[model samples]
Target: MSKARTVRFHEYGGPEVLRLEDVEVGQPGPGEVLLRIEAIGLNRAEALFRGGHYIERARSFPARLGLEASGVVEALGDGVDGLAAGQAVSVVPSFSQNDHGVYAERAIVPASSLVPRPEGLGAVEGAAVWMPYVTAYGGLVEVGGMRAGDTVVLTGASSSVGLAAIRTAHRIGAAPLATTRTRAKRDALLKAGAAEVIVTDEEDVAERVRDLTAGRGADLVFDGVAGPGLTDLVRSVAPGGTVLLYGAVSGLPTPYPGFDLGMPAVSLRTYTMPETTRDPERLRRARAFVESGLRTGFFEPAVDRTFTLDEIVAAHRAMEAGHQVGKIVVTVPH
Candidate 1:
């Protein structure tokens, strides 16, 4: 066993509850591999999980807190093949944090969750890439069947996943309409490849979408902030289109829009990153799609800030501040 510094929370509360401690890390077990972590990615889900608002509650005290990271293989367990020691890799969000979290100097993770880091991608980019891109690809391409010339409405357009969806839509010849609660991020969203930006606070979302789509409505609506506003997003969808709900940042109860509200013949579905990462075939496709975009310079991960592992509490504070326009990453110094 080796000593490693890890982040843990003993109680459900704010970032103040987090504690960094030294712990023993044992060898990888069957179907697992030991990784020397280089960087850790921050997600709103991690913040939600830390605050006990996530779908999956912590199974035990001193619960771990992370799902994404970039590292190098230190050792491989039995039955784990096709990977070698010293190979650079990125961890996918296929497993629960309760089972394997990545916020540490080293960690034991399932071999199936490993993906070879793309060429020329540094630890920070590797750590930041998978979750957002996979979520966007799975929702817009795989599930929604987004096509060329399609109009996609991306709510919470300032988020990492929302920005990724914008680029992914452009990659597929689709036009992305980005939405933000305020105009503070309007120009940044446009510069990030959004065809248009709609300020939810100043404009009627449905009217803006209709005007942008020439009254046909959007072909797909990718929403991360689900709440009362979902009704307007539902009304913004074209007939036969879909409204994919991926996150609940609003922290409010989302009621299904009744048919009497003139809601179109649309499908409302929810998505999580694990839906794509957990399936081998789906994960394979998602990796290829994202890597290709990266190689061609079509997809560039927008990192809003970086922090040292010791500043985990501050990082979570930044995440909850809800003002960042991109991914937040934490570097694990060896």
Candidate 2:
């Protein structure tokens, strides 16, 4: 209809800043489409944005939240093509936060960011797939040059993206050695496709890698949690190996110890999914890779919990608690 429920925050703080309100929906402009948002994917970026700690700060009050969502196409703007009303679709959060967001009952999105929802997946699962899969695909395949038999160390193995990396590595025949903060999640990480789980609190990550890989260290490291342990991670890499720094859970600057830099053989690189999406060729390659994985059952978005529109605060709290084994999703009634 004409009015929709939207999530916004007037002030930057904790989850308490979030407010749900009824907003009027305007007609879609050229290259835009109206959607009945069925499910939304909760991302750390949204939390960071809400807290005013992300790279992009809020320019105005009552700022919107969300990027990834799945819905049915309700209407199309002028010049839109190759889509019809009632078609199921997943929307990628590739545009600027200033221009668009999807945490609403109804949303206007550019057709360019919309893709046909893969078969065998519902709206909630559809919303959970894009970011993690794309980030893993781009980092491991495109940037790391991971292949069969390569050894990968995945940090923050409990995050949705980290879990996806484990699955993708297994599908490619690469060894995914994951690290978690405690043994409480050790079993779940192993079940999620990790070849081995290293409990950082109980064991040394670099020593464990040496033991697992026969002293060769990891061929690549998928690092999402870059804190004081970054030094240990740097030491865990094989000579000439690469480390992909994606996120910082401790909110601390990743340290590069002197020994890590002395060796020209090792490297550290930071990656963001938007880097892949911003390039036409890279975007096409990533999309094809993930699409094939989805079709073949090699990759699936595992949702650890689901929340309704009313429980947004609890959802964020759960996410911040770092207890979820997979993605956190928010569902809306039709």
Candidate 3:
């Protein structure tokens, strides 16, 4: 068939507005591969894009928003090698400008964007894996310079990316202290390899860090929630420690007390996964690193549930609910 049925948003607003309809699917051209999408990972960024708050949607209307998928290579375009048909694969959907999105029965993506699926990993897990794993790997190994025995503090521990950071830190022999706003997830966080779990609602997170580290504080901090959350993270870090700001889920800019930061001499920086993946070398390294971790059972994505293509509205609403742990996947099994 030359045409495919897919989900699309004509205008940005709420989940109820995203509609599923038929669209034309063209053959892959030059290093591209046509995939029968088995699973499509859902992320908070996609939610922002749907609501028109994301930077990627700076252009006009009728955008198909999804960034990661896992499936089999149905057909390969010219100049592609070593990749065969019906081979299970996980892909990072970084395609832009007139490309088929992952939230469909079929999608055409670049071969460079596809990576072989790890042994014993299923399509659902593969779909939800790349973004969080790569984000954590890039920040912890490449940007944060996390070392063995170093103490690290991670905020938003229940988040998929945050949990991946926790696992990555453990793999590197660093100490990971996770923070959660709710008590319900404290045990889950600890079981996920967090050395310590701090419930923000019940404890003074920064003070607890001082107690845990004997006042030296943490050596590195990975933060996804900005605003006041960053203030606590800053206070939790050691004098020479680095704080990496990667997201602002609170929708508030970080408030930094300049005098204290300057007096104590701390390093604060921001990072984005796209920036790290922009360089082909860095991207390849990240992909290999994550695949190795998955193969070794060191890294596993938390998938809460799966939805069909027609369930687009409910899927979006579920994401908005904020109760899901890890990644939410949308399956389009044709």
Candidate 4:
């Protein structure tokens, strides 16, 4: 048995409810691996899970709460192959947080959920890369069949996933039109490889999209903010184009615009990370695609800031503040 400092919340509330406590960790059972954590990646889904707003609620009190992390393999369980102890690895968000969370000094996760960390990638980058890049690749490349010369509009363009989407679009020889609520992030978005930045508050999203696409509208609209504004985003889609609703940071109920707006030949679909991560074949393809992009310099993990494990509360606060331009990482000291 080992003692690990773990983060858990006994109740559903704000970041204030998160508590760091010492817990006993046992040896990895069959098909599991023990990891000495180095860094943890933060996602909005974890925040939602912490606050009881996620699709899956806390199964019990003192619930665990993390999805991705980078670490070194401490030990491997029976029946695990192709991975040796002392190897650098990263945890993919393939399992439920309620079953195996990574916000700790050490954790035991399924061997199938482990990915070998690349040679040049550090712990922080490894932790940051999988969630955003895989999400972007899964949604745009795998699901949407995005190809060269396509026009993709990325909502919440300053986010880590949004930045990854821009890079993925570029990788496929497509043009990425990034959308933010204001001009504060326009230059940054452009610098991050967005072909164009559209300020939602300053201009009509659909009109700007149409204008940018030479009156054709976008071939794909990758939306992380789903709410009443979905109607306008749907309008921004070209005929036979697709609108992929992936996240709900808007915190409001989304309404279907197809019936009310009578948009013809437009398709709207919902996406989540599990759509790719849960399937072994899909995850293998996604991992290969993202790894190739990283190797060729087409994809870079954007980290907005870093915090210590003890400051988990502050990290959550910063995430809720919504000013970050990239991924929020938490470093664990051994």
- Report, for every candidate in turn, its global Cα lDDT versus the true structure: 0.93, 0.89, 0.83, 0.94
Give the runs in model 3 whose Cα sits over 4 Å from its true position.
96-100, 260-263
Query: Against the true structure, what is each candidate's TM-score?
Result: 0.98, 0.96, 0.94, 0.98
What's model 1's lDDT at 126?
Answer: 92
lDDT of 4 by residue, 194-260 (tens): 9999999899999999999889999998999999989999899899999999999999989999988
How would the candidate models be sorted by TM-score, starting from the highest? 4, 1, 2, 3
Q: lDDT of candidate 2 vs native?
A: 0.89
Candidate 2 per-residue lDDT, tens place, 225-300, comes to 8888988888889998998988877788768764655754778888888888767788888888889999988889
Q: Estimate candidate 4's RMSD in Å.
A: 0.8
Query: Model 2 Cα displacement at 35 (Å)?
Result: 1.1
- Candidate 4 accuracy as TM-score: 0.98
Report how far off residue 320 is in candidate 2 (Å). 0.8
lDDT score for candidate 1 against the true structure: 0.93
Candidate 2 runs further than 4 Å off: 258-261
Candidate 3 clash total? 0
lDDT of model 1, residue 311: 95
Estimate, for each residue in 1-334, the C-alpha lDDT of model 1 and write its tens digit.
6789999999999999999999898999999999999999899888888889998999999999899999999999999998999999999888998998899999999999999998999999999988889999999998889999999999998998999999999999999999999989999999998999999999999999999888999999999999999999988988999999999999999989957676558999998888888888998999999989999999987899999999999999999999999999999998
Q: Which pairs of residues collide in candidate 1?
A: none
